[model samples]
Target: MSSTTSRRTNPVDIIVALIGAAMFGLVLYLRSIEVSWYPVLLLVAAYLVFAYLFFRRQGGFGGVANPKDFYTGIVLLAVCGVFAAGMFDLPLGRVARPGVAFFPLMLLVLLFIFAVAILLSGLRNRGEALGPVPWRGLFIITGITVFFGATIKGLGFVPAIFVTGFVSCLASQKWTALSATTTAIVLTIFSWLIFIWGLGLPIALCGSWLRTALVALGVAGESIPFCY
Candidate 1:
């Protein structure tokens, strides 16, 4: 491929690829870290950055936003920060299984309340203007992420990629078996090399029990005993 042939692709494509590379790299770096809250922080930051980028790409942040989105985001940020802090701080007696779970629950509640408030306020204010959400794209993206997160460890990269990409393509109404299969394989290889070899992150490529054992050992070996 000539340099001019490569240059035919837009800068946006390059930027997006770099973002994905950085994110995957960060995930590996994060896995190596001792802190539990780093994932939460990374997730929150990713959401914020993506949200801002989406709005910017769409021209602006929705409509004449007085304090709805900003206020909700700020409140949720505080809630997420608190829960993240609690879950990560071992001496605080907050366990991950339950403590980390509350943040999503809180988010659901906040989302519900925010939606109701926005609806009522819009009704009272008479006129309202907001950009249409790309529901199809959002649903596909979310489904893919959930599928990957849930199945990555147990299924490893291959099956997880197939499942996630196929299901996501189905959700997005662009189901193509060949395309999905090819994409999944490519992604799995990319992820494996990047996570396992490039960054040295510990993800289970072995069987479930062995993986669990290894992870437990890793955690145990990495942990420092607390002294009162």
Candidate 2:
């Protein structure tokens, strides 16, 4: 706590923080500032949680003694619950025309199964120690998703997708800066075409953040859609 030498990577704490962040993000995605007063409170709460988790008195490998599968299953179950809770907001259209929740709900089904099995395996002592977690990979992937979900309203679809893509590429073992940039660019363009032009979704190409900056610069800010 007092010295760098006293600090160590605490993946469990990190992962729990990540999950909390992810849930906060999910709340944003579901509401997107539609609700008043509470989101700010939630943001402040999330900050407190991360601060406590990251800055609390430190130790080596701060996780449970259970096998990796156990905690992994537990986390997955938590994730499933988060998604399942939100599934009600999304329309569950018929099989011919699936709603936004359809795919995620289906995946949650599979995840529930896998989470249970892995958790059982962990209880059975069939897996290795929960140490040496792929914390970096998990952090990169989940962290980016959480960031995207939390910022999508402010960043909008294209920017959110691009940022998520770039950060996600960094998680890959064979990623280069050029490659990541190119991929993000291509992804942004394709998404803009699909979600903007093709689907005609209400998502803004340039979100409120850019719109506000453009407004400050006296650059066609009044014409911006979804900047409200």
- Could you estimate the TM-score for every candidate? 0.36, 0.45
Model 1 residue runs over 4 Å out of place are: 1-121, 129-136, 206-228
**Per-residue alpha-carbon lDDT of model 2 for 49-68, expressed as tens digits?**
55444434333223433456
Positional deviation of residue 222's Cα in model 2 after best superposition, in angstroms: 2.1
What TM-score does candidate 2 reach?
0.45
Superposition error at 54 for model 2 (Å): 41
Measured on C-alpha atoms, candidate 1 has an lDDT of: 0.50
Residue 113's lDDT within candidate 1 is: 35
Candidate 2, position 110, lDDT: 52
